[model samples]
Target: MSILATTRTVARHRRLSRLELAAYIAQLEGQNTALIAGNTALAAQLDQAANDISGLSEDLRVARGENLRLDAALTATNARLANATSVGSLPQHVSTQPVPIVQRFESGPVLRAGASPLAAVTAPGKRGDVDKTQPLPVVTTT
Candidate 1:
């Protein structure tokens, strides 16, 4: 009877140990699942940030290009102003000819075809006769 009682006690202990181990395993699996979810969320956020950074970088490049173009134009205008101030002290008289289109180069402002050279020919009062039937010349510049 004493031996039989000891066998029954050992069997009860083994059953309790198995139950504890199963509970521990279940808890560990739950923690692992939570960690995997957190990692996925973090990866998604990192991908979004990378995309935003690339977009901002492209915008910065475009802005820089536009700024360079505007700076060149401003520099050209300032040079033209300085040249005008150095050439003559008095203001020149305003002529009645059409306002000429000015092109700026590194050297200076280039006079267009119908500008200062032909000012005398194209004055408002001394203008030549316009043949209305004639087609206007189409000019192309490279």
Candidate 2:
């Protein structure tokens, strides 16, 4: 072949190769653009999630502190409460004091309201089988 024609063909072939390389580079650039947009969206979502987690962690910390405070207050107040309450000390005062024993008894017959039934029961118009009406006695265990 003539040298001039050979050089022209070689130049044309190189131009075609350059065109193909440019098209491939353009396709990779388009893919990279799409990937950059996807990465940006993902970063935004991750940031929002991290913010939410921080808020929840703060709320949990506050709740734990409040619970500890309440527990300490309750412990202090319980320690301050009295073991027992009492009125003026007297022998009759002992008799008048409220019965602390819980009675689990079911209904025994109640009196008809106007008298003593036994040698001990006391009401309005009653003397028992004993010599005189006396106050119902209460026995206390020391």
Candidate 3:
């Protein structure tokens, strides 16, 4: 071939190669952009999953605390039941003394003008007009 024709052919081949390289670079850029977006979405999902796990861990901790409280209550109830059963197994004996049934009437504390509000409670049925038909009131001292 003539020198000018050969130079033209080489120039055309180089231009074609440059266009192919540019197209390949553009395709790689597009793929990189898609990969970056996918990575960002996956990272968000991972963060959400981590938050969910943290919440579940807190719930599990609360449940464990509640279970421990229930277990303590169960232990106390079982102890009481054991004590009651043991008491039931003991011999029963009636008391020799007759139990008296006492009756009582309660009155609000009387306020004398100068007296402190924390005054002591008085004996019941101390009022003079009490009828003999009613049983005498019992006085309780603390």
**Best model number under TM-score:** 3
Q: Over the stretch 1-142, how does candidate 3's per-residue lDDT look in tens digits? A: 9999999999887774767989999999999999999999999999999999999999999999999999999999999899889845555563344434331235234345433333333334576643323233445432
In order of TM-score, best first, we have: 3, 1, 2
Q: Candidate 1: lDDT over CA atoms?
A: 0.72
Query: Estimated TM-score per prediction?
Result: 0.43, 0.40, 0.46
Residue 50, model 2: lDDT of: 100
- Report lDDT (CA) for all predictions: 0.72, 0.69, 0.71
lDDT of candidate 1 over 36-94, digit per residue (tens)? 99999999999999999999999999999999999999999999899878845455574
Predicted structure 2, TM vs. truth: 0.40
Inter-residue clash pairs, candidate 3: none
Question: Model 3 — TM-score against the truth?
Answer: 0.46
Candidate 1 wrong stretches, greater than 4 Å = 1-16, 85-142
Of 1 and 2, the candidate ahead on lDDT is 1
> What is the number of residue pairs that collide in model 1?
0
Best model per lDDT: 1
Q: Per-residue alpha-carbon lDDT of model 2 for 1-142, expressed as tens digits?
A: 9999999999887775767989999999999999999999999999999999999999999999999999999987776553233334345535564555443112233344444444443433665443433344444544
Q: Which 10 residues in a row give candidate 3 its minimum summed lDDT?
A: 101-110
